[model samples]
Target: MLVWERPEPRNRPVPAPLSRDRIVRAAIRLADADGLDAVSLRKVATALDVRPMRLYGYIDSKEELLDLMVDAAYAEILPVGDDWREVLRSLAESVRHTAHEHEWLADLLGGRPQLGPHALASGERVMAALGELGVDAVMPVTAAVNAYVIGAVRREIAERRAERTTGMDEKRWQASLGPYLRRTIATGRFPALATVVRDAAHLDADDTFRIGLDFLLDGIGARVSK
Candidate 1:
């Protein structure tokens, strides 16, 4: 059973009155500072000034700890409303920003379904905004936007890590590719590719996310009107 579905211990004789919230918060702090692998039951306990075994009263294992972390982070990702387009747009942008803020978020998001309260709340906000579409359509619409958010976040963060590793941002990376691109495009074997190489303005990640999000939202808007 999931840790949230179980009762928290009420009368543990720990030094501090530890709640699940406190434990989860401490764990997230360790993760944010040193990355996810740096977080452990011992590390979280040390942060809380308690024994590692004390955490067992609130959470059972590392997997459960990750679940709590993901759900809690979802609190920052809840959406705002305007039209459905605006609502989902806000959601997508918020999630992207949240994942960037907590870079480890992109890793845990793919592992399990986020059924915790805050995760459910984030979904509810988007789906309710699209409620005009009726029950059947609302779910798929929300799912499509969420799919884009998840995929975009992962790719954005992956590139971010790569940049960090090599100390090269997009422009420098593209500059490195320039020689090979020039040699390949000279043959006139790939006219479409050559034009993009020559003419396309290299957009940064933020602009790419915005433009891609528009594609999904515009398609959904067409369906909503029909």
Candidate 2:
């Protein structure tokens, strides 16, 4: 199912009738149906009812197709406010939304960023927004924010997939762990764990994401001010 180890997209000397957009779209559909791992030139060709080698006329490799797919996903993300902080937050949330919609996007995002036109434009927009904050080292600041957002989205997606596969919500999982947790608490062995469970309200994904975003933005602000 892994595309990386699969055969290369058959190369062709002459231009095939298939357009790059059509191939990328087909690959995206394949990913949607069976995940990014299931996407391959061979499979995409089958989906398009063309020979695997024919796809090479448009796409060089699965890696390029994946990069295109990532950019295509990026193309769907909307740009936000002109303010630096607001822009960063909006962009991150937009990416998170896209990843949530296409689970395969999360996997591809963790790989190299596609410097394709749409992806580069997104980066440029983020950097331009940071200009509002008088950030001289725009590239580094943007990279840091990008890294933070990517890491956050990746964790979010993986955890969501885990929950789906297990068919258990957080409440159910916590309830199942209740006995063991209570037993540990009863022994008074871990005061911190006991105190947290007693005092802390459970945070859902959105709440946790907001809290984490605020914390990260606080740090970024401090850096910007310095």
Candidate 3:
């Protein structure tokens, strides 16, 4: 004899209504508070007071949520003045500021291809600015600017994270390593680096970023003028 029985339906909690925008915002908040690794679907669902399954309707995976978050961040960056140099400078500064505010952004930026609407709009604005300047190779120029900004911001974020983890600022960290550095410099085999280690002025991260950006832009200007 065989017995057939229908299993009882399990009770599941009803999830609150959630939109994509709300989901993305919640994820951003999580990331802002506790770095990118903290932004998981389950965490975001908990923040939104919804079941994790409900988030699946709005966001497919962590990567998709990150893409949406990146787009949302880009949307915060409004267009500046029309002058090409000013526009580019303003864009770089804005991105740097945004990266500082959202430290996780430095991790994702330039790490993947961003084709979201807001990301595309940002690229369009930069391209238009270069076009206004009669840049013959707009893509290369835009890429160069993006490369500089992304690299600079990534370095800034890395140093910040390192300091936070080590409980020491750059100066203190250097001082801690002073004995080893001094011994290595005394070997007289690396004169140029020794000179820099001994004589280089200590610029804070922000100043270093701006100075490097200005130097890059100066080279671009020289090329354009020629």
Candidate 4:
């Protein structure tokens, strides 16, 4: 059963209550500090100063807790612009921004169907913003944008973790690869890619994300215009 479907404990609003909200908040903290892999039910219980078994009263399993965490993160994605293009652009960018703030979020984004209230409300807002479009175009077109956000967030987070693990920022890392890249390119096996590597703007992740999003938004506009 969905966590939201469960009845809240009578003590929910009481001080220091053991409730779903508290549990989710605690779990999100753990995830934020130590990535998703470090967050287990036992760890959350420890964070809350409660016994592991006691958490079962609030959440049935880790999966449920993850759903709650993702929904909680969705709270960070605010309402966007009135125009559908701006709506989708802001929506995508906000998700990317929030994921950066809470890196663990990338692990679950678009990986599951988020039915939690906050997630549903965000979806409703998007749909309302896109009401000018044909009903059929809304889902698929928006889905395309969502897919892009998911992939982009994952890639960004992966690069972040890589930088952390390797103790090198992207610039230095790429520079370190310079010799091998030069040697490989000299072989004339990837002329086009080598040219891009040498001449492309090599924009920061933020610009790259925005540029990719603009491409998607333009595509969406063209699709709707046709």
Candidate 2 lDDT tens digits, 140-210: 76677668777888888887777889987778888899899899898998999899989998788888888
**Candidate 2 Cα errors over 4 Å, as ranges:** 1-17
Error of 2 at 9 (Å): 15
Q: How does residue 191 of candidate 2 score in lDDT? A: 96
Which stretches in model 4 have alpha-carbon errors above 4 Å? 12-16
Best of the two (3, 4) by lDDT: 4
**Model 3, 39-136: lDDT tens per residue?**
89999989999889877655557777888899889987665766778778888998988889999998888877777778778877887888855867
Report, for all candidates in order, the number of backbone clashes: 0, 0, 0, 0
The TM-score obtained by model 1 is: 0.92
lDDT of 1 at 185: 92
Instruction: Give me the runs in candidate 1 sitting further than 4 Å from their true place.
Output: 11-14
The full ranking of all candidates by TM-score, starting with the best, is: 4, 1, 3, 2
Question: Which residue segments of model 3 deviate by more than 4 Å?
Answer: 1-15
**How accurate locally, in lDDT, is each candidate?**
0.87, 0.80, 0.81, 0.89
The worst-scoring run of ten residues by lDDT in candidate 4 lies at 8-17
The CA-based lDDT of model 2 is what? 0.80
* Candidate 2 lDDT score at position 142: 69
Q: Per-residue lDDT tens digits of candidate 1, residues 1-226?
A: 7776888888767468799999999988988887898889999999989888989878889989999999999999979977788898999999889999999998887566789999989888887888877778887887788788889999988998899899999889889998898898998999999999789997878898899999998898888778
